[model samples]
Target chain A: MKEFKFLIAIWKTNLQSAMEYRGAFLTQTIGMMVNNFIYFAIWIIFFDRFKDVRGWGINDMYVTFGILASSFGLVSLLFGNAFMLSDIIAKGRLDYYLSLPRPVLLHTVASRTIASGMGDFTYGLISYVASGYFTWDGLARYILAMLLAATVFVSFLIFTQSLAFWLGMMSNFSNLVLNAMLTFGIYPITLFDGYAKLILFTIIPAALMGAIPAEFIRAFTWETLAQLLLGAIGFLALAIITFNIGLRRYESGSAIQTEV
Target chain B: MKHFAKYWSIFQITLLNSLAYPGEMVGRSLMIIPFMWIFYQLWKVTFSTAGADVISGLTLRDTLWYLMLAETIELSRPPLARTMSENVKDGSIAYILNKPYDFMLYQFSAAMGETIFRALVNAIFGGLTVWWLVGAPNHPEGFIIALPAIFGAWFLQFCLNAMIGLSAFVVEDVSAFTWIYQKLAFIFGGMLIPLNFYPQWLQTFAKMLPFSSAMYGPVYLSVAPSRELFISVMTLQLAWITALTILLIIIYRRGLTQLTVNGG
Candidate 1:
């Protein structure tokens, strides 16, 4: 119960900070919407030229893209600071979180949130609805898939952040890795074959996040649901293990004493 | 001549600095593989059917190889434009101005040095990896002829980027300009798709623009082009480079005068 309250407090603080910059926040939100629309436009052009790209048509692509974009937006909106934890850790600012009464992971993850992600979420919602890609039955599966996707997204972020404990500083490295994952995550997994597919499913799991879940949405089946559930559980376990391992190497900071 | 020597020395220093970070360089190089894979698959799907020949006059194999080479070359190009804007914002440009060398020449040399280092790394390692995994271009002769055109493309890109960076003289915030420039490059420069893939009228317009010259022209020249066509592309690139270079010089002179007057 206490931890729950702490989470709320952290979220409220993030919201407050975001609201502090009214004009810039609004501009950033609009800018993100424009940016995401441009990417969608590029993909639409591809679908226009090729009727069926690897057996996936325009509607199928939109569905997959919608899920990925929404999940990405949700992750960024809630856990933006988690993405930058590697940078904070490298700069020795992790000490501040450690000194807090709250769990370091929770505090760090909730420290910052991007208001612009709201724009992305809005865009995703509008695209999904306007395209008529999801039927009534598919909607239920989509929601379930989104829940699982969120879990995996947060877990993967934690796994990457934990690297800071061992690597010392990994802001640039983390940024590069995350950018690559984002770029890879939007496309259908079937496009990848052999070793590439293996790597995406296992190490990066970019395929399972959207592409596989998307398959589940298009054609709901027990087997597809099982796969997503299994993957989500496996990734969550791995993330927990990685974080704990990193904790063993973590050194507490003196700066925390002064800050607190 | 003396100023040239000074600028050359700075360029050498920049080259040495890049060489010092071998791990970072190798890591960044390895990172391009996923993007390469994405483009490779995208073109593969687009050209998998026989209809590919009708649209672009490229076989599936030909299109894939052209895209592969173009992506590798584009990735290897130095990130000069962003670096210049950063220098200006951080007041590092002041130090360059204090020196006897022309600030523009010094920055250009540094960019050239980094570009040369990156090209060497790409050729020795990146080129080999692309060949072993994705397969090399069908026409080796085309690849050879594309070299000068590629050099011209790089020069034109550098000058255009320099001009974009020069906007810092007037704009309080240059980051917005940089963001717009990069996004435009991805679209207009044919970094995302071949210019030929666009509508016929759009393709013609893109060809006339300097951005397409940076990415698409080189790829087209590499696949299959007559000697005359290759030379003509090179000449156009040279014209853009000359015009952009002259514009940059004029902008830099005026910007410096403005800075001096404002005691900046």
Candidate 2:
């Protein structure tokens, strides 16, 4: 309970700081929302000409984007520091987190928030509705999907950022993997087969971001639901284990300042 | 003619600086392969649905090639807007103003140098990817037109981004402006699907915009290498360049006046 309170207080302070630049915050939020919307528009244009891709239509795309945008937004807004974890590790900035009594990774993630994620969260809901899948059951499934997707997204970041310990400054590699996942998430998964499909489910697991969740929502299956739950839990465990292993390799280098 | 040597030296420094970051270059280049793979799959599905070899006068092969070219152009451009905005934020523009070289021209040369190096890397990587996947599309005798056309496109893209960067004088952050500009270029400029696939009205609207000249012109010319088409596209690109350069000059003057008044 005390740890939760600390996390909330830090988030509140970050939100206040972000609000200090209200105009910039709002512009960034809306700008990112529109930036994501353009991807959907591109798909829309493609569908307008070609109508469907491997039986997946524009509406499937809508929900896919919806889940992706919302889950990503939630992570960025609430746990923005995950995005910069590699940099923090590479720079030996984990000293501050180590000094704190709380779980370092959790506190580190909750330390910052991204304002633009608000736009993504909003865009997600709007896209869900626009896709005409806002029924009560749909909403429930969507929420569940978002939960699993968000978990996978966070775990993915942790796994990538943890490489800083082994690789000794691999922020570039982390960023590369993250971007590849983003590129894969926006595409229709039905088109991928063979090794590419295997890659989507494993190494990068881009499907968690959009495809599997969207599929479950489009047509509910207990099997897929089980797979998503397993994938999320499995990936989360892997990330935590990897991070802890990396932490064993971490060394504080050239500390310039001391904090009690 | 004398200042050309200055720009050349700056370009050389920028090129060498980029080469120094080999890991970053390789990572960035490798990242594009999946994007192209996705595009390949999407276009294949679309072609299968259309039941025709030529929608918008592009075969699956042509569309795939077009996507590679468009992505090459898109990725080659430097992050001019972000760098400029950072300079403005940190009051480094003042230091730049005191430098011997023209700030805008120096930055442009740096951007051009970085872009050309990245473009060459992407061409090799993307070319190999295409050759392995779908084989290279046949080009007409006038394939040489693409060189100048693509170079012109890069300049136009840089000018647009630089204008957005200069807007940092007024705006707290120009990321929003950059995002809008990039999306406009991607959507209307024929980055993913050619403008030919767009509806007639959108096609006309996109044609009139400078974004199309920067992206669509070069990609289209690569596939349909007609000399008449090349000349017209190049002319359009030149006109936009002239107009955007004048706009950039006005923005730079105003930004400088603001900076001086505010004691940047």
Q: CA lDDT of each candidate?
A: 0.72, 0.85
Q: What is the per-residue lDDT of model 2 for residues B88-164, given as tens digits with 9 covering 90 to 100?
A: 88777778778888888998999998998788888778877876778877773434668889999999998999889
Per-residue alpha-carbon lDDT of candidate 1 for residues B1-264, written as tens digits (9 for 90 to 100): 764788889889989998998777776666566666676676666666434444567665566666666666676766666676666667776776798767778778888778777766655554564566557667878878898888887787778777777766654235444545666666677767777677777778778888877877887888777888787788888888888888989988887765522223
What is the C-alpha lDDT profile of model 2 across A41-131, one tens digit per residue? 8888888877888888889989999999999998898889999888888898888888768898888777888888898988998898999
Residue B91, model 1: Cα distance from true site in angstroms: 5.2
* TM-score (all chains, Cα) for each model: 0.86, 0.96
User: Whole-model lDDT for model 1 versus the true structure?
Assistant: 0.72
- Tens-digit lDDT string for candidate 1 (A1-260): 99888778877877788888776566667766776776676676667776677677777777777777777777778878768777776677777877667677777777778777777766666666656675888777777887777667777878887798899776657766777777878876767889988877778878767788788878888887887888889888987788778777777655564321
TM-score of 2: 0.96
Number of clashes in every candidate structure? 0, 0
Each candidate's B-chain TM-score, in sequence, is: 0.89, 0.95
List the DockQ of the predictions in order.
0.37, 0.71
Error of 2 at A179 (Å): 1.7
